[model samples]
Target: MYDRKDPYYKKAKQEGYKSRAAYKLKEIDKKYNLYHQNSRVLDAGCAPGGWSQVLLERVKNGVVVGVDILEMDSLNHPAFHFIHGDITEDETVERILEISDKYDLVVSDAAPNTSGQKLLDHVNSVELVQKIAELTRKVLKKKGTFLFKLFEGEDKDMVLKGLRKDFDMVKVVKPDATRKNSFEIYVICRGYKGEQG
Candidate 1:
């Protein structure tokens, strides 16, 4: 359970970010410089709009498109578009493709619904990662970047191995904003080598 009293949580509330997860992307971007002026971004599993909010901050002149099964209240930014749908569905992927030609950056904070059983949760998480990988292949521009949130488990190495084949560079990172006890880690993939439009 996340401590509501945590300083990052407090800072998020004070600064009007929808969730403390905002800082994770901020820190990631600080290190990788993922966003650029007028850059197009796809935020998968964006709920309550925190990652989208951070993307908005970076892409003032660009577009930030978000999609998730959960309903997210509008961020009220001109550059932001929210799609309320399950990203695992073909319709949802089609919707995303319809709106943007290709994304310069694709970021997913998506996690499978936990079943309390660790192994089951890991399997489900890996399934979601596969879906996200397919989506990335279709929509991510060549040489684009993908930042994926993943749980450390037996299947993680397999996932990373496949990602290495798709991207020029693939590495794991645990941002400072992530809970130290959490198994969650971010996989940053750069130079997408997927088919171009």
Candidate 2:
């Protein structure tokens, strides 16, 4: 059984972190060595900015640009930047390109608004993951890392196969911080192979 009183939950409240999702990214970075002192990151679906906090702390001179559909209260961190918009939109992409330099990493935690249908939920999750993958290929620097959330389903193999074609290595990870009952998993892809024109 999962512990409701996990240390991360306690730490989040104590440290004023916006969400427990912060520990998920912390653990992912710790295990994969993703974030670095000088990294420039684009965070898609960053709303409350938990992951942005982690990135800000890890990267010494790093800059973090976050985008989400929801409005975020002003954040004053020197290394943190936020843009409110839909990442799937071309205008939003152009806006990101304007503010972003070379991206060392791209992290996405986007999820569809669930409709309570299991099959529909799975399909929506898969589509979001594919969309993130496509955007990563366009915006990420060569050898940049891409991390995004996905749910296990029939489309899992297809997603993995497509990822393999563009990434040197793609791994599915279930972080210890994630709930065991939850269908969510993270796809960590390293070394972008450059998108075809």
In model 2, state the lDDT of residue 23: 89
The lDDT of model 1 is 0.91
lDDT tens per residue, model 1, 1-197: 66888999999999999989999999999999998978999999999889999998869887899998999788998999999999989899889988897999999999998877778888888999899988899999989999999877899999999899889999999999998777888999999997745
Candidate 2 lDDT over 1-197, as tens digits, reads: 32558787778889888778888999999989997888889999998888888888877787899999999886678888788998888888888788774688999988888777778898999988887787788899988899999877889989999999888999999998887677888999999887767
Model 2 stretches astray by more than 4 angstroms: 1-7
Which regions of candidate 1 are displaced past 4 Å? none
The lDDT values for all models are 0.91, 0.86
User: In angstroms, how far off is 151's CA in candidate 1?
Assistant: 0.9
